[model samples]
Target: METVKRVLVTPEAKKVIDQLSKQHGKLMFHQSGGCCDGSSPMCFKEGTFRIGSSDVRLGEIAGCPFYMSRSQFEYWKHTQLTVDVVKGRGASFSLEIPLGVRFVIRSRLFTEEEFARLEPIQNG
Candidate 1:
C-alpha cells in the first residue's frame, strides 16, 4: 500500500525546526483556525502546551507532532498540509515570532488515490 502523508515540512521550515529544537529541545505544532492568532500554525516546546480532547493529531512535520482542533480537522481532512516558513511576524504566539519568521500552512487537496492511502488521524 502506498503511504500518503497528511502533513509535511518544507526545507525552509525544517531549517527553522532544527534551530528551534536546538534552542528548545523538542517541539510540536498546532494549527490555529481563528481567535487571536488567526490561522497561523503555532509551534511550542513539546509538553509545554496542553492537548485537549477536542484536538486531533494530524501527523508530524520535521519530527514534531502536529495537531489541530477536531472541528478544524473536519474542514481540512481532504487536503494535505505543508508547513512553510515565511518572513514576518504573524499574529501568533509561536516561538518563531521572535525570530522574524512564522510558520504557515499551505494545502493541496488530496487526489482519490492519495486519500485512499492516507494515514489515520488520532483524536486527542
Candidate 2:
C-alpha cells in the first residue's frame, strides 16, 4: 500500500523552508491551540522548541517534523494539513516572521479511505 502523509507542503512553502534550513541548520514545526500566533504553525530551529510528552507528531513537511499538542490534535485528527507560505508578518517567534513571510496551514478533511490509511502518530 502507498504510504499516507498526514501533512504536505506547497512549493512556495518548500522554497521558504530551503531558505530557512540553510540559515538555521535544521527545523521543526508546532501548532498549538492557544490564541494569537499559537494557532498558526510556528517554525523553529530544530531542538529549540521543546516537544512535550503530550504532543503528537502529525508527520513531516519539507523534511521538518511537524507536531501538535495532543489536545489540539483531537480537533484536527480527521484532516490533512498542508503548509503554505503567505506574505505577511505574524506576531510570533517563528523564524519566518523576520523574513516577512509566515507559514500558514491549509487543511482538508480526509476521505474515508484516506482516513483509514493514515500513518500512526508518535507522542512527543
Candidate 3:
C-alpha cells in the first residue's frame, strides 16, 4: 500500500537539525498548542522530554520523532505539516534558539486520496 507522510522538514530546517544534532545529539519534537510557546513545535534532546500517554506520534522529521498532544492532533489530523526554518528567536525552549533561526510549521489539508493512504499514528 502507498503511504502518505504527515510531517516533513524543509532543506533549511534540515540544515538546522544537522547543526543541532551535532551539539545536542539525538532530538525529538513536540508540537505545542499555545500557552507559553504559542503553538510552536519545540525540539528537545531525545529522552530528555517525557512523552505522555495522551500524545500522538505524527511522524518523523530529520530523523527526529515528532509528536502532538491528543487534543492538538484532533485539530490537525486532516492536514500535512511541513517543518520550516525562519529567522528570529521564538519564545519556546527549543534547541534552535541559539542559532538565530526558529522552526515553524507550514500546513495544508490533505487530499482525500492522501488521507486514505496516510500511515496510522501511534498513541504515546
Candidate 4:
C-alpha cells in the first residue's frame, strides 16, 4: 500500500541551512560508517539551508546551492514536517528511513546534478 507522510524542519537545522545558503553554495551530504558512529547526518552544504513557512529556504553558505536528502525529502514528501498549515508547503511522498543508515538534507529538493552525485555514491 502506498503511504504519505509529512516532514517538519527542526529549528536548529533551519538555522544551519539559513547560514549556509547566504554564502551561495551547494549542500552535499553523505552517509558514512565509523566506529564512534557519528550517526547524525553531516551538513556540508555550501549555500544556505533555509526553512520558510512553505518551502525550505537556503541562504548561501559558500557560494553554492543547498538541498535535502531522499529520506528527508520523503519525510517532507509525506507531510511529516510541522509547519504553519497555511504557510509551509513540502513535497508529499512516502520515504522509508533505511535500516542502520543516516541521511542528510542538503537542501529541499533534488536536481539533475544532485541525482548524478548520489548515483555514483549509491552504486559504489
Best by TM-score: 3
List model 3 lDDT by residue over 1-124, tens digit each: 8799999999999999999999999999999889987888899999988999999999899999999999989999999999998999998899999899899999999999999999889987
Which candidate has the top score in lDDT? 3
- lDDT by residue for model 1 (1-124), tens: 8689899999999999999999999999999989998888899999988999999999898889999999999999999999999999887779899999999889999999999999999987
17 in model 4: Cα distance from truth in Å?
0.9
Report the C-alpha lDDT of model 2 over 1-124, residue by residue, as the tens digit.
7757889999999999999999999999998577877678899999999998999999999999999999889999999999999999999999999999999999999999998899999998
Candidate 1, which ten residues in sequence have the lowest lDDT sum?
A: 88-97
TM-score per prediction, in order, is 0.96, 0.96, 0.97, 0.30
In model 2, which residue pairs have backbone atoms overlapping below 3 Å? Answer: none
By TM-score, is 3 or 4 better? 3
**Backbone clash total, candidate 1:** 0
CA lDDT for candidate 4: 0.32
- The per-candidate count of clashes, in order, stands at 0, 0, 1, 55
Compared with the true structure, model 3 gives a TM-score of 0.97
Report the alpha-carbon TM-score of model 4 versus the true structure.
Answer: 0.30
